[model samples]
Target: MITFGFITIHPNQENTYITEIARHSDSNTIVYRFIPTAIDPATEKVHGEKFNHESGVWETAVFDIPMYLYDRCFYGDDPLSIRSQPIMNWLKNRPYSTFIGLGLPNKWEIYNVLRSDEELAAYTPKTIKASSVPKIINKLIKDKKLLLKPKNGSQGKGIIGLMVTKGKVEALTHKNQKLITKSFLSKSEFSKWLDQLLSSRDYMCQQLLPLQDVDNHPFDIRILLQKNENGEWIEQGRGIRRGLKDHLISNINAGAEVLKYDDWVNALPVQQQALLTDGITTIINKVPKLLEREFLNLFELGIDIGFGIDGGVWILDINSKPGRKVILHSKEGKADELYKAPLQYSAYLEKQSLVKGVD
Candidate 1:
């Protein structure tokens, strides 16, 4: 029996719902959640633990047994706000512990190691920052549209696409959600927007690659990867998302629809499919290795791939804390199974990696 603690947004993320199913599927393991609630007369265990309204942390009445742990608490007022530092210190003293979502001891350090546009571009057709946005825009005048994105962002957020028309430049979200319109009209205007956007967050100007369309909507692929019980990183599920008509980005969170990867790939030309697979594989293989060497610990990641009209496959983003809403809503439910593997694998790591009475 292994105790798995959850310090996350929702209690279900503690893997309680999946643990029973996993027990039946896995056979060799027993998993349980540390539920804080009213104590039963017979078991003397608390139930419905109260959320510390003032501190914004959920308090567990009993300090139970959980050899492994997962951090899924990023919702509401943020449970980590009050408990993080002490909880992390306590985890250090525990026999074994592991986390599922983002925010571990040295996460930023790990991100910096794998965060390279050029290294990333080697595998996928990605447009990194070329001198400056104005410079890049000046060159793309012929193409008319370009995309600017923060180097570090997720969920299709902070993506700005610029359209140049008759020497005028307009900015829009990746979904073609119009943000602001202006003429690169003047150097001062371009410089002002560039400075505002660049200073807001680290951004890279990318050449807006063309995308294959479904019903006139551009789409992209999101491959969620996780380490299996065997300790090998495997692509859990690959899903394609079609953006709204005329939108350049295809993130499901941004109103895109998810489809099976095979279904989408089969629809493309054979040569195109091969290029997509090879390009995606090239980046995926290198990214994990880089993360391990630089970030210290990262067991899973969500890799986003976008295809251009010219048939070039591009890397859009890498999400360390991936969203599972699409998978949960997938009809086949394979997405659900795939998503569950990480929690189980994290438990496996806790049992195998943490030696008794040692650091």
Candidate 2:
């Protein structure tokens, strides 16, 4: 029987999704979940949780690292994350094991790649490393608005909106699910605040896009794409994520509301709908292929797309280890498919490896 492993930073992380995946595994395959730190380097065994099919529960067990791995580790500035980085690197380099997706680089690196593609360049935003506080302040002064995003951030964390209004620089961010606004009277004060923010982590600056809805709430289209059993990329689902009024981000974690994709699109005028469809089609068709060509093979992608007030389509973010909340909310009856996807893909990989005599 083939073995599949789900690796996360914490044992409880993504418990629901992991449970569902294990429940869906066929008799020919087994599912296990573990943290990188759980591996015993000397013994080459992992002391982790294994799913018991009969009882439908996860039990503590010790076993060798699974041949196929699903990496769900999200790192932060925490010590655990720092320690796990090297362990994950070691696992990735192991000849006997493989990750379902190798994952993508930081946001700035991804931006540099997408912008270089002629077709993707038009949709890519102008981004620069937040290396100079003075330069960022100058741009905010000139353009009146800019967005500061952590280079490695996800779930709409560490995003700040900077705007110069009425002779004051205002910084807007969400904290504890509440909107927090702070104003600076002088460029020196604003620059000092920005410097402090940048000191903790790397950041990127981009000219703010008009991604707000008619109600002035920020919104974006989130599309989930995954490779099927045949190892071909396909769109699994898409949805509209609407943020709180006057917010900087539309992440679900930041109190965003999920809307059905068809509900949003069908309400638009026929001509506008046609245009939007064509634009979305062009992006979904080209992005997966382009990214795989530029980087390593990936199993899935969560693409965040935005439509500016100027009627321009833009690529907001691309996540290799994507969450399924948007898909589950948007598409009814997709629970089974989503749960079984990893297992099916793992089976395919096992077949390929057997044919090539890798194992």
Candidate 3:
């Protein structure tokens, strides 16, 4: 039998999703879930939970590390995240273990690679590391507005929008799912605030794009791409994610709403619809191939594309460890396929390994 593992920082994280994946797993496969910190380096055993298919419950167990692993760990600045980093690095370097998808690097590194691609350059936004407070302040003054994002952030967290107008500066960000806006009467005050924020963590700054709808709600097109059992990349689904009116981000975790892609596109003018379709198709075709070539092998990607008010298309973000909320909300009857994806791909990888005489 083939053993497949799912690793996360918390035991309860993604419980439902992992359970569904286990339930849909094939007869030859068994699923286990573990926190990366639970692995005993001395014994090469992991103290974790195993899914009992018949009872549909996860039970405590200790076993050897699985041959194939699906890494779902999302790290933050917390202590637990700090401790697990070196352990995960150790696991990644283990010769006996194989990850379903070797994840991508930070946002700054990804942005540089994407901008260098000739075909993707037009869609890519110009980004700079927020390493200098004075430089960021100058850029904000010159551009009139800037968007700040954590270099390693996900789920739309740690994003701030800054706008300068008539000697006053305004900043907007989300905190605990609520929009918070603050105004500074002088550039000096805004500079101090920017300095403090940039010091807290690494960040990237970009010229703010008008990625809002007619009603002023920020929105983006989220497309999910995954590799099939044949090891070929395929479009799993696409949907529209719209944030609250005047919000800076359209991440679902930030309380955004999902809209069916077809419905949203059909509401636009015929010419505009064609333009968007072509643009989306081009990105869907080029991004995955380019990323795999530049980085490592990847099993899936969640590509976020933004359409500006000026009819410009922009690639806002690309995530390797993507969430399925947009697809589950926008597309019907995809639950089974989504659940089976990991298992099917794992089986394919196992087959390829055996063909190469790998144990």
**Candidate 2 clash pair list:** none
Model 1 weakest 10-residue run by lDDT? 30-39
**What does candidate 3's lDDT look like per residue over 1-359, in tens digits?**
99999999987899899999999997799899999999998898999999998898999999999989999999987988999989999999999989999999999889988898897888998889889989998898799999999998899998999998767889999987689989999767878888898888999999999999989999999999999999999999999999988899999888899999999989888888877888888889999999999999999999999998887889999999999999999999999999999889999998999889965
User: On a 0 to 100 scale, what is the lDDT of residue 117 in model 3?
Assistant: 86
TM-score for each predicted model, relative to the true structure: 0.70, 0.98, 0.98
Query: lDDT values of the candidates?
Result: 0.59, 0.91, 0.92
Query: Which tens-of-lDDT digit does each residue in 180-263 have in candidate 2?
Result: 999999877877888898898999999999999999999999999999999999899999999999998999999999999999
Instruction: List, residue by residue over 1-359, the lDDT tens digit for candidate 1.
Output: 45445444345564543443343333333334442222243543324332333453445455444455544433222554344444444554545345543333322333344456456645444355545656765756756777776665556776777887665677776434433444568757877877777766666665677675746687877777777776778876677778777765777767788887776689889988888788887877887666665544666777777777677766666766666645554436475566467556766676666656375
Candidate 3 wrong stretches, greater than 4 Å: none
lDDT of 1 at 147: 75
Q: Give the poorly placed runs of model 2, Cα more than 4 Å off.
A: none
